[model samples]
Target: MASSTSHQNSLPLPIFSGENYDFWSIKMKTYFMSQDLWDIVDKGFTTTENPSVEQLRQERKEKQRDANALYAIQQAVDDANFSRIMGASTAKEAWDWLKEEFQGTAKVRSIKLQTMRRELENLKMKDSEIIKDYYSRLKGVVNQLRAYGENISETRVVEKILISLTEKYDPVVTAIENSSDISQLSVTELIGSLEAFEKDWVAGMILH
Candidate 1:
């Protein structure tokens, strides 16, 4: 039972392909942290010349941890991505090499982020689209923007949804705006309210 519980605690590392570098990196970092290997990956181990007995023991332990970290990274990437970091001797080297190859330069990230921002701004709930589908589309754009370091607040997202909804939702939107504190309304709560309103609206139309 204990062994089964321990096995369950070990999460499978997320495999990295050529795309979604931001999400993959985040997941990898978290995985490394869970295994207590992030320190070696983030800041590599250093060897001391003519070390004392205790220092030598610590060095051996660190070296083993470093090897484990590197092996974890190697296993987490696909064939193409693994090739990019094949020459890396340390976990930090592998991590940095993959970051440079996939994440691109700061300027490139800035340009991508700008494009995401524009997409978010242009998003609107189509008259025929259901609330669930529209929110999923909006959330995807917001997540990509956030992964690129954009600080989009929940309140801002709530406000965006309120304004971007179609004219058919105007009455519900107005009621929500007038009755509730928009600043405190969570995205989940707003979605629920809108979905409930949609069901009632549809039922009314059917009756008419």
Candidate 2:
């Protein structure tokens, strides 16, 4: 049976660089789901021996769809990545190839995670850096840890922010520490209060 939907307009977003695999994976998943073709990409179709005519036709269509999706994905990536997965026979094969290429071996990923943990533990907001910039740097490290499969809690992030900020923020940090439970505080809430204090402090300095 022919598919009710047309896939002629289905276009892949772009090739994913190895470093931003998580973001690229999200876009690719959404694109596949939108085109009603994720199943082929996720699980390749197998042909059965002595199949009926209808079954053979269905299998052929499945292969064609998989090929199209694979091409779309291939178009968006760099030459090196393209060359790596160019020999894949199906969309699932290509997907697996990309995953392994970006994620590397378990031992390598473990080492990467350990390094990120050390960076997070030793993170300190530079004296010249603003609150927003510091927060972004902190979040980047946290997100990388997550991409590597470690689970970081909101409280842990909040604690890091409070302790690592510069001495000028000491009064605000002390206030927050005394008034609120650091373990229960969200990073969002902590940032909001600190940013407000920052604005006021800046305004006071300008007036002086």
Candidate 3:
């Protein structure tokens, strides 16, 4: 004798694969069809066109800061010996290229550089980008993400990560970079040396 069940269950099959495949097919179709979407929506966009004098000044400053970030990420890659799938010069580019190589279900493969000019060409992707990247991370991480798009932007989040890291670790990293022996430097001298190290860093990132 066999028991009858209301739930028609075969072996517990993974529905996620089916759902995700459907989502990708739909997303790609939508993207291909959305030719006029950017023109219409981006009427309100923060354009890279005709930046103000102050904006130009800030761009110079940001260029320096951006270079530092690029250097730091380059150092991370060099120190970690993590190989690259594509030859991207900057961290953002490298990260972007790597994602395309590694992730399968994403909508776009290659993005134009002009698109990243301001907020990386508005591809900066509000919260949606983070959600997309979050999905690519360890399976469970996306569940921890907050609901807002601005919440994931560098203006609020990634910059916080950068600033906190630079402030907190800059002192120790500076001491290590300058001192021949970490044991030899006095604490006060160590602090002073770290401040001076920024001259070299600023020159590399800001002026150059």
User: Each model's number of backbone clashes?
Assistant: 0, 2, 5
Of 2 and 3, the candidate ranking higher by TM-score: 2
Q: Evaluate model 2: give its TM-score.
A: 0.76
Q: What value of lDDT does candidate 1 attain over all alpha carbons?
A: 0.89
For candidate 1, the per-residue lDDT at 73 reads 89
lDDT of 2 by residue, 1-208 (tens): 2343344344437567666886687678778888778988888788889999999998888888887778777876788778888898888988888877787677878888899999999999998999999999999999988877789999889988988999989999999999998888888899999999999999999999
lDDT of 3 by residue, 1-208 (tens): 0221112122122221223332333343243233222222112123257899988876665554334434433333332224552255444554344335444224432132222223322222233233224223312222122211112332333222223233434565644646555445453453355446645655667866
Query: For candidate 1, which ten residues in a row score worst on lDDT?
Result: 1-10
Identify the candidate with maximal TM-score. Answer: 1
Report the C-alpha lDDT of model 1 over 1-208, residue by residue, as the tens digit: 3553354247687899888888998888888887788999999999999999999999998887788789888989999889988999999999988887787778887788888899999999998899999999999999888777799999999999999999999999999999999999999999999999999999999999
Clashes of 2: 2
The deviation in Å at residue 128 for candidate 3 is 43
Model 3 alpha-carbon drift over 4 Å, by segment: 1-47, 78-86, 105-208
Q: Predictions ranked by lDDT, top down? A: 1, 2, 3
